[model samples]
Target: MKNKGVVFTTQAAMIAAIYVVLTVVFAPFSFGSVQVRIAEALTILPAFTPAAIPGLFVGCLIGNILGGAMLPDIIFGTLATLIGAVFTYILRNQNKFLAPLPPIVANTVIIPYVLRFAYGEAIPIPLLMLSIGIGEVISCGVLGMILYFTLNKYKHRLFAL
Candidate 1:
């Protein structure tokens, strides 16, 4: 039991670290009105284990801070990731194809407002939503799905929570 706890903590920490690294490494596209945030690809982690929920939340918070995002972004953006992760975990047992839907929808719905209000971008709301949705589609929908398939094969061993 104690060992299981340790493993859980370790996995969460590792996921957080990876999220931060991926966000920072891809800093150029990780933030801004028009962004893809490849680190979002990790948002699918929750489908594997609940630990990924906090892992992704903390990672997004830190990534926002390190990426120098505005206040609303730091708070609300992290919230978006948290919301997405929670939903992803809840829907984890559903079709594997649907695993990324939560994060994609959460970010698509939330990020446009963040970009407009937080960063004071002058884009139209609908346009902002479209751009943000496109990014989410690429990051969480496309890339995240690819990641899901890759991890699915090794999930039993790699994420044995």
Candidate 2:
């Protein structure tokens, strides 16, 4: 890609914007005890570009802030996304199906505590984990797989080499 720096920056910014818009548009399903954040499907983008690591982080930060998230949610929730994206980028060489696992695992484990401490939700941790895990399976597993394949075809054109 010509002007590789600009291309990478632009792609990352676009990914971040798309993530924020998707999360905000589905804000109801994007947060809380059982979250099915459709934007999480894009967590697979790191397989295509390292830029996705930061893109997902910034997008999640903005999403949590605009979703009326509390302090712990804002801090820890974004941290989860950051960790997930980094892991996803690191594991990019593995099977495409596995790329979304980090985000799924990270959020499944961390968000339950965020709910309990941040919102004082009365649900037990195990149940919250199960519910959140299931939602993540849908969002980051099923939907992420779909996005992976869809973008895989255009990745050569869409991302910096």
- For each predicted model, how many residue pairs clash, with residues at least 3 apart or on different chains? 0, 0
Give the 10-residue window scoring lowest on summed lDDT in candidate 2.
Answer: 1-10
lDDT by residue for model 2 over 1-55, one digit each (tens)? 3887777787778888999999999999999897899999888888889988888
Q: RMSD in angstroms, candidate 1? A: 1.1
Q: After superposition, how far is residue 88 of candidate 2 from its true place, in Å?
A: 0.8
Model 1 Cα lDDT, one tens digit per residue, 1-161: 44888888998899999999999999999888788999999989899988899899989999899999889999999999999999999999999888888988888889889988877889998898888889998999999999999998999999886
List runs of model 2 lying over 4 Å from the truth.
none
Candidates' C-alpha lDDT? 0.90, 0.90
Instruction: Give TM-scores for every candidate, taking all chains together and pairing residue i with residue i.
Output: 0.97, 0.97
lDDT of 1 at 74: 94
Model 1 lDDT, full chain set: 0.90
TM-score of 2: 0.97
